[model samples]
Target chain A: MKYLEDIGSYFLMLRRTFSGFTKADVLRELIFKEINDLVMSSLGIVSFIGFFVGGVITLQTALNLTDPIIPKELIAYATRQSIILEFAPTFISIIMAGKVGSFITSSIGSMRVTEQIDALEVMGINSLNYLVFPKVIALLTYPFLIAIAMFLGIFGGLIAGVYGGFISLDEFIRGLQEDFIPFHLVYAFVKTYVFAFILATVPAWHGYYMKGGALEVGKASTKSFVWTSVLIILANYIITQLLLS
Target chain B: MIEVENLKMRFGSEEILKGISTVFEQGKTNLIIGQSGSGKSVMLKCLIGLLKPEAGIISYHNKPTQEMNLNQQRMLREEIGMLFQGGALFDSMTIEENIMFPLRMFSNQSRSEMLLRVNEVLSRVNLDGVNTKFPAEISGGMQKRVSIARAIVNNPKYLFCDEPNSGLDPKTATVIDNLIQRITHENNITTIVVTHDMNSVMEIGERINFLKNGLLVWNGTQEDIFKTKNEDVTDFVYSSNLFKKIRDVQNS
Candidate 1:
């Protein structure tokens, strides 16, 4: 019953958050600015880390496939499978959880501790919609942005792999074409969407309930990152097994 | 008019407010005065619906707050304005944006209309030409004035001020107190101000309710405050050294 109630409340918060997209809403600037700074701008660093991790996986696959039982072409195939199916979405979520989760937690927690949230409520404004909803909507939207990030990350790895002679450009291109199934893309989408929701919601929930002062805000921020990261990795493993198996 | 009936609030094991019932008339500064931890602020919060009273009924005019639906609660909330102790201005927004916020949220006014209303409230608060200033850029007194402007911009029916004179110099405190009284009278709104400052009590205590240990011990006008024979009230009223010296001179 509590879970159902929470979902109902979540939808209400979502409606209010989206309703605030007007040019005049107090949170429009905050939501858009956070999306740009925390999601779009972090793309380069995420792509960099994703690219090398992809390369290392490809190299390892190449070394493993040298036995007579496997074809060298399968090395590129497995690399595509890993990146598209699990690696890109899961790793990028962890990165964003560190970035956006901590940001939401600290910002909202400090607002609560400072009585700014209470002030908003007193002003006949819905503080939860003003504060939490933006970040949650941004979280749901930014994962698709991170999906684009994953594609770019994989593209970077493909370029570096061809340059380093780990695989030919033709083989890399062929591997992506051959191994990229519809379910791989679906898995990527599912993982990222769920991760994004978790990353945004956990921090905001903790932050919203935070008390005391600056020290407690700091603690909420730290706890948000820790709990969100744990939940992401755990959820990643569960979702992958459930979806793929 | 605002009426609170048998309002009670408990925070875990501590009973913060104990059956606070009072009526604040329209167009008067209804002051809640008490020392720290005397539940004055808690009573104010309960009246404003910031804290749910464990037992009691608060009515705006004749509508009981507990019976109002969410939309009704929101409507009642829109009719109310609050000036927080710290001003509570959105730190990220400019003064213009802050003042325009409620209009944009609740009113269907056009951009030009909102801007006009915003400018009118700004001028009313004597905050002309500071529209672009951030909350952080303003002085404490100026922040209080801006908060006043924001509170009144909505043309609220009830104004709740929690410590408008707090953390200000005596001169600034007087200015804020005077501003609140002037705004209250101009709008004919029932203004409920919670404070421990006797200076404010003397300046605008048109109707004063004194709380001690979460009970409304004294309810009277400022004239009644000084003229009363109540020892507790006299001890609290004349305890200041300045008032003591004045008393000595008058007696001599």
Candidate 2:
């Protein structure tokens, strides 16, 4: 009975957090800056990882497609699918989980343990609305920035292929243009939204329920990163199957 | 004014608060005093909605807390200011920012107006020139003062201090106690303080509630406390040699 009640309260709190996300003032003040930072601040690391992975996947896919049964155009197709649907959203959210998710959890968890949340509540401020909503809203919107990173990553692959003399710029461009599908892009963007939600919610929930002193705040931060990363990967695969099949 | 009626709180099998009840009148410093494990803090938490009680109701005025919705509960909470035991100021923010936090969160005050209010509260707590200093640069007593400034910045109707003097030196503790008393009187707010310190009980115990094993054992004014015949209350109060000597000298 107690466990059921706890679950019920958790859902209620989650609903409260979501409703808070819908407020225009909160979005304007808090979430906008967070989205800008999550997208802009992480650009360097995402670009660095994106370029290297893009090069490797391109090399491997090109070498395998040398068989007469497979068309050389298939390499570009596979790269497009991987970069948009998987690499852009999943890997970027994983990196974000390390950076932004950990920050939210630690800050909120410490506030919880230290009675800052209590202070807010006593002041008639909705602690959940004030603390959690902006974060969720920012995270929900930040993935569009990662979609841009996907373009850059694929561009890096084309550059690497041209530099290595595996494929000419004109050939790569032609392959990409011919292989692109509108539905794939839509599917990829939708996947990013889900990844962002998992990344934001898991960490926020962990931080919200935190108890004890500084040690517990540390624990919540570490757990937020670990669980968010795991959930992102698992979610990526499930979404892939659901979308494709 | 606040009234807790037959409040019971439990953590699993451990009953941290058992059938505790008391009233804290407005415009006075009301104290809840007990040993460390005697459930004083738990009762405070229960009153403030940090912890939910398994039984009984806490009322602000005559409105039962259990009857209020989340927003109404939040409204009641907003009418409160709390000085945490650890002086839990936000580390990333400076003293000015820390003091300005509640005003920013709960009030529609503009930046300049918020700064003016922050300065006023900081001056009230004697933290005039150190507005930009981080919490690390301040002493424990100063941190408590900053916490006090933050608490009062919103001009709350109820002020809760959880061990407001816990780690301060004697002089600092007195400063915090005096500050709380002064703030209570000035604002005419119902202030409830939870502590184990006899100094606090004597200094600001306009009304004191004694809790023994999670029960309200006695409630009275400081003068009434000195005249009480209850052994438990006397044993708790006169346990210190300084208090014992004072009691002996007074009797003589």
Candidate 3:
């Protein structure tokens, strides 16, 4: 019953947040700041994780192909499939469920604790639209992040495969092109956009409706991370089943 | 002026405000005083339209608040300025940005015009050259003054303050009380301040409503408060040795 209530409240909050925006000029500035905080700052960690994890997946696939008939090209194919289909979209988002998710929760949750939100309401400002909408717009750049992750992940796999003598550069490149489905890119980014909305709204719901003090802000951050990750993973499964099957 | 008629509010299982009806007069520093948990804050929230009451009529200039649509309510709120108990300054913003926030959100003033207005209110609050500083960089007293500056920067027709003097030294608290009184008189705005501090009552309480357990037990001026025979008001007013001695001296 409580979970159902939370879900209902979450939709209501979304309606208010997206209904009518306030002060477009000021909101433009806020959107830029959010882009810097939420998207730009995340680039470094995402790149590093994407690159290294791609290499690790390549190495694991190479070692597993002990049968002689299984072409070395199978390695490049497998690594490409893993990174594009799963790692870039799903894995990186779960990472951000901790990084960006907690950030959204704590910043807004701290505002709730100090009565800043109440101050906004008393001033006739739509606190949800003013605070959360900018984040939602800023995260429209999220698909860009996954695009970079997709490239870096495949590139890292190439480096690892050729350097480790698992496959020649030509063979690996050919393997990457072998039976490559054009729609997989579409499927991956579709999941990213959905995950992006989930990332912005869920943590904000926890922060905006949260009740308590500083300790509760911390608790809300933890809850946001858990719930955001759960929702993202669930969304990943749902999107894949619909788009692929 | 603001009027409340039979205002009532409740949480899940408990009522916080029990049919409170009172008038906060225009151009006066009206105060609601009560013990903690006596619904002082609840009453203030209700008056500001932050918390909708279960049963009551809140009227501004004879317009019932419950009848106002969202746009109408927002227009009403635009005329209001509030000073929260904690100052509620935006942590990420500088004092200048914080004060200019309402202007930027609701007005078409150029940045230069807004900056000039911000400086004017800062001077009114006796804060000079602190615009570049953040909330965390200032003292609690300065922060409260900045809050006052923000509240009045737009020249609101109504002002509400929740515990304006809490978490301050007595001397600083007195300064805040005087500042609020001066601003109230200068703008002739309807102002409601909620506090339990006796000093605030004595310093600037032009109209006082004394509540005990969500009920208005007494209503009078500061002078009338000292002379009232109501037991609840008497017990609350004279609970301190200093006020008790002052009352005894008055009697003699």
The DockQ values of the predictions, listed in order, are: 0.50, 0.41, 0.93
Give the Å shift of residue B141 in candidate 1.
2.0
| Chain B TM-scores of the candidates | 0.97, 0.98, 0.98
lDDT (tens digit, per residue) of candidate 1 on B1-252: 998888888899898888888899899999998889999888988888898889999999989998999889988888989999988888878999888888877888888999999899888877799989898999998999998888888899999999998889999899889988998998899999999898999899999998888888888998899788877677878889987787789889
Which candidate, 1 or 3, has the higher lDDT?
A: 3
Better of 2 and 3 by lDDT: 3
| Cα deviation of A142, candidate 2, in Å | 1.9
Q: TM-scores for chain A, candidates in order?
A: 0.83, 0.86, 0.98
lDDT of 3 at A240: 89
Error of 2 at A218 (Å): 3.1
Deviating ranges (above 4 Å) for candidate 1:
A1-34, A59-70
CAPRI-wise, candidate 3 is high
In terms of lDDT, model 3 sits at 0.94
Q: Which candidate is the best by lDDT?
A: 3
Model 1, range A1-245, lDDT digits (tens) per residue?
97577557656656665553333555677678767755777777777787778777777777667676665567667877877776778777777777778888888887777667887787667787777666666666766666665666567657666777777888777777774678778778888888888887878877887778888988888878888889899998999889988
- How high is the DockQ of candidate 1? 0.50
What are the lDDT figures for the candidates, one per model?
0.82, 0.83, 0.94
TM-score for all predictions?
A: 0.91, 0.90, 0.99
Candidate 1, after superposition: displacement of residue A188 in Å? 1.3
Q: For candidate 1, list the clashing residue pairs, or say none.
A: none
